[model samples]
Target chain A: MNTATIIAQEIPDIEKIRRDFPILDTKVNGRPLIYFDNAASTQKPWQVIKAIEHYYTNLNSNVHRGVHYLSQKATDAFEASRRKVASFINAEHDYEVIFTGGTTESINLVAHSFGKQFVKACDTIIISSLEHHSNIVPWQILCEEKNAQLKVIPINEKGELLMDAFKAMLDETVKLVSVNYVSNSLGTINPVREIIELAHSKNIPVMLDAAQAVQHMPVDVQELDVDFLVFSGHKLYGPTGIGVLYGKEKWLNQMPPYQGGGEMIKTVTFEKTTYNELPFKFEAGTPHIEGVICIGAAIDYINEIGLEKIDRYEHELLEYATEKLSEIEGIKFIGTADNKASVVSFNLENIHPYDVGVILDQFGIAVRTGHHCTQPLMDIFAIPGTVRASFAFYNTTVEIDIFVAGVKKAASMLG
Target chain B: MTINEIQDELIEEFELFGDWMEKYENVIQMGKELPVIDVQYKKEENLIKGCQAKVWLHADYKDGKVLFMADSDAIITKGLVSMVIRVLSNHAPEEIVAADLYFVDRVGLREHLSMTRSNGLLSMIKQMKMYAMAIQSKVKAN
Candidate 1:
């Protein structure tokens, strides 16, 4: 199914769509709640929520194990999710999709399995300074374990990566390059396609941490020619404890299994054991069945509305928010990339981000404030943290106005 | 004044704010009024764990009273720590350790605070009481 037709679909009525998310209607601290924390986790739509409920109520069973009707049903739903994810990201085959806990686990799987098989002593792995701790730590651990070195691609004061620096880091010794498609802290949309093409020319593989990107945009893995891509289901408006790691067939065939357990095994003995095929080889234990199935529902919900429309809507909202918030006094934007996501990280007049966050909460606005698991990025900017307000499609411009007032009030209160 | 009496006083003071904005302004002012801890006491040992904001607290026992001096990089956290210091400072070590901090709930900070901040507040109280307890034990041993 070509998603281009989905793109052609008219934009959904924003208010009508907001009603589908029950949490949007609630109040916080005696005021109508305005949630701008979408970068942390997008709230689940009723469709995805009901999918979970329906699974637990009727089709509750351990997938790929039981001979009962329920188990078969569970297994079908589980694989269906993988296929849906394959389509969502435009992976060539469903076998490319491997489920794990989330982006953290997805990166760790590649770092361990791919690194163990491919990375050698003295080999260098390239990463950006803008990565979340999850993306950075796993590679660091891999490099340390393998006696390999980790090289960093530096970013400018505006949080945009220096592409020339990225190119300079690529060489024969550069075994792998891992970077985030969208920075979690600053919302800088890295030129991932260019990075991938350049690295591929050097015979180096690239992995994308799309935890923040996939929900807000359409990601085509085949078009980008990325070796690996990953995202968390919860952040995509699905249940938690589910994520996907998409690797090319050739890479999956070469790398060793990530874990040893039942479903992932082809055959076992007291002697040597054989691992399962492409995906199951990596998926070792009993997976989050409900989370997997519901994520399918999440994709369906998004597709029904069309990702093209969602991206356009969110872009406008980001611009609107940036303009509105820029009017405030002493507001320093952490990122000002030409192309960016919906995340806005800034500080108010040297008032601690935590203080600003506390005051905003009183007005029933939810904005994430802190390092945002990007401690290294924080170090680059030479501050403790920034106040981050991220948006989604369901959020309205009226809420943005309320948020502006909240920030002004928070700043004055802190003063 | 008794701890309960001081707490009641604070609750009454907070009641005048028609909305949360004014209440938070008061907190910021209280934070500014909070005495800073000596540089020597802002060690890792004085830092409270599991808080979003970095907080350093120090307590000294003088003339049968426990006095708390604290600092936080975040104004909101500083305000919360100051509230703890205000209720317990200049009180006997035993009274400082035994005082029930109902003012948190009465001023509605207990409800307003997120779990992390509330845990931080509890951690501050725990550290202050621990200091008082150590002083009490040392006094007896001497």
Candidate 2:
């Protein structure tokens, strides 16, 4: 009906793409479902869902230890997933990839093992204000145990990290720098390439919390020269309870095993024990086999449509939503960084975000409200929280229109 | 009115609404009309946990009846809080403790009473019942 809406409807074969996700066709509150919570977790396409059903139906066995046929089959499929993930992120080696419970565990693996190995008292670890609590809390725990100081790179009013402040904070005492490639709360695509290069120049390793970044864009770790990267599977349209932690082989070799169990060790004795090599050193247990394999299927799904196309389409949705939403009265847009992904965070004047979200939910629009596990970021904005509408490729401009209308109704009703 | 009678009255009133939006509009109006809690009692200790919106509930026991004052930063939550207070306030502690609170479901706002809602209506109800039971014990002691 508006200019932005008209332009965004031009993306081709969107209906076909939408058909792949059965949930997209489902109803919520007697209205057609409009899923805008992609930042939280994405809906699975039939391909990825079928991959899960297929894995359990045929290949169900313990990987890496089985002498039986099913075990070898499972092992081959699991290792093949590792390889797919390695190539998906362009990791130098498949052995460099470690499967953890989720992004939180992957981060803890680094914070615990890497921290135990390298971090000492008085050493500084730097993170950005835009980090989710997953990235913040692990470092806090690591710093607390190691008696290390954790520093934050402050952000401006627009939610963009101040690079000059980051540059000034870099020194010999700073051991590792961890920040998100894209802020989960703000949708700011951080200048990670620059951050990685800068940290590398100081001989400090950099870890990227790519939980919000990997699915939205094609992340080539070698191209970024990043020392470590982490992302969750569910966010990428895969099964839940699985995540990828990609570290340089050098760093993975140096860090001790994260957990002591059957899969992570080569030999065990009363007085002497040895950990397994590279990824097994960090994995520590039988991994989530279904999650691992189906995440590869999710990758295949993303590749089928291509990340660049998905990125472009989602960006269009973001722009259209932002434009349509701005037309409403007294609506304040939060996190207006120049570079953003498929997210728009905003607040209606004098109306609580929870109130807005409740109204929107009635209209069958699913958006995230509240701090989004980034309470510190909410404090920085000096507001209770903002209504966040995040998009995936399947979401269309018509849905955005309904969402905009719902928000306008909410604002007028609550104003 | 008795607790069941009050719940029946609420269910009757809610049945008049044609849709969820109209129902929500009524709730928002009720939120605007809610009696504000005293500023002194709006402290962190009185705050309800496990809610996206901050709900502050304070109770007063007088003449064997538990009177409640509640507020929330979010208007819809405040509205829900007001509905809760309307149902159970000015009742004997035992009656308040034993109230079924089926009106929340009968009125089609059952989702708010769900544990996964995070709106704190369920938590608020629990807190209010807990307060009443505590008062009931102290009254027996006297």
Candidate 3:
């Protein structure tokens, strides 16, 4: 079956799903809020919110060391979250999942731990033109430190990754390949599975930054056979300051600990220190306890709704938004990739992105403006930034109508 | 302080200028109403760094009060400078130091400003308040 037909067959009731998020009901500037900034962070469902409250009220304690009842319950809940995260991404074992602060820290952990251990002088690390600064800077720092070369896979004018360029960059010297599963700025859903397979054939390990991908579709780490995958909980209807860094057991075992502190260590003496097993070895110090538990609830909520259904509903919204937004005079849409997630970045003729954002906010329509942490991509386009409107499954065509009207208003006012 | 008081003065001022286009046309006429800064004071020290338009601000303390003179290359930005000077011109140093410029939102002018322009306005206000505080500190030391 074709992908579009499979997607359309599993459509969800978007309005019903929208009711689960309380923040969407609130008004901004005396108008009904039309949130289009889902790329930055998604609104939390009641289930996720309640999970956080429940943790604080009923099962709040430090994990791993204490023998108390609360401590045991907390540890079980914390470790249970790891299992859920593993299953969510279809990883083989829960031990592969290490909880970090967010996608930024997760990428940094791989760069510091895996890059430091595996990378050597004169080796190459390949990333794409569409990478977030979080993904790019870590490897740049690693390359600078280890005297390695940082190679980039170029993108087409449509913001699609040039697969040929990616393949050309891979050679015997290319030790690691890291790329985003979806471009946050452009919303291009990359051919990550193929990219991983190609890299692996060259004997290079691949890390996928799934920050923008997890919310849109199912991510099977085993099926892709990526060495590492990272995603933030907040981008998937959970709290901020919590994320998962899933690495292959072999890689995780070989790599050094990201941070050295209390919880990550098995035992510490004046003479020597031994690290904990699997996941705990990487998650050091006091972790984000409440945020971790809330992620499990978010996983449950998404699972109940089903990602296939969510993807369909969101694609419908994207299609509608794309059509409506295109009707405006002088509106230039960016990232016309064939396989895109639910984001639309664009610029209006002669109007600055900041001006567009301000006018939209007046109508209670929220959109992101500026480089979107992909200044390299901006440099590629030769523009400073684009006004980005990203959608979630819960968002409606009515909201898009309001958004279109707001954009028209901005165009008339500023243009 | 009331909307009516401000509206009345604004409308009267608008009537004298006829229309937005005519008022926009009469540059020298508008400059006649604007309080001027000394040419000697137009140094790099007075320049606001991030503005797309060239802007200069100078202030003086007189009779325990602060007075400001400001100008901008852009006409609309000059109007914004005039609005700021109107609120802050004759205020005492301590009062100026205490005043929260976020209250500009109440008058609905801030709603029209872009976030970048609002941030620029904020930076300018912060600098002015810093100058006021510095003068206050010097007075206390004396």
**Candidate 1, residues A1-415: lDDT per residue as tens digits?**
3322332243447767988999988898778989999999999899998999999998899999799999999999999989999999999999999999999999999998999999999999999999999988998899899999999999888888999988888989999999999999999999998999999999999999999999999999999999999999999999899999999999999999988888899999999899998789998989889989999999999999888888887887888889999999899999888889998999987689988887788788999988899988898888888999999998877889999998998887776
Interface RMSD per candidate (angstroms): 1.3, 1.0, 7.1
Candidate 1 per-residue lDDT, tens place, B3-121, comes to 77788889999999987667777888898988768899999988886446778887777788887888988887788888888888889888877889888887878853456553266
| Candidate 3: true contacts recovered, fraction | 0.00
Q: Report iRMS (Å) of candidate 1.
A: 1.3
Fnat for the candidates in order: 0.76, 0.72, 0.00
Off by over 4 Å in 3: A1-12, B1-106, B109-119, B124-142
CAPRI quality band, candidate 1: medium
Ranking by TM-score: 2, 1, 3
Q: After superposition, how far is residue A52 of candidate 3 from its true place, in Å?
A: 1.1
Per-residue alpha-carbon lDDT of candidate 2 for residues A1-415, written as tens digits (9 for 90 to 100): 8655554455577878889999998898889999999999999999999998998899999999989999999999999999999999999899999999999999999999899999999999999999999999999999999999999999999999999999999999999999999988889999999999899899999999999998888999999999999999999999899999999999989988888988888899999889888888877778899999999999999998899888877887888888899899899999999999999999999999999999999999999998899989999999878899999998888899999999999998898
Which TM-score value belongs to model 2?
Answer: 0.98
Best by TM-score: 2
**Would you estimate the TM-scores of all the predictions?**
0.95, 0.98, 0.82
In model 3, the Cα lDDT at residue B12 comes to 53
For each candidate, what is the lDDT? 0.88, 0.92, 0.83
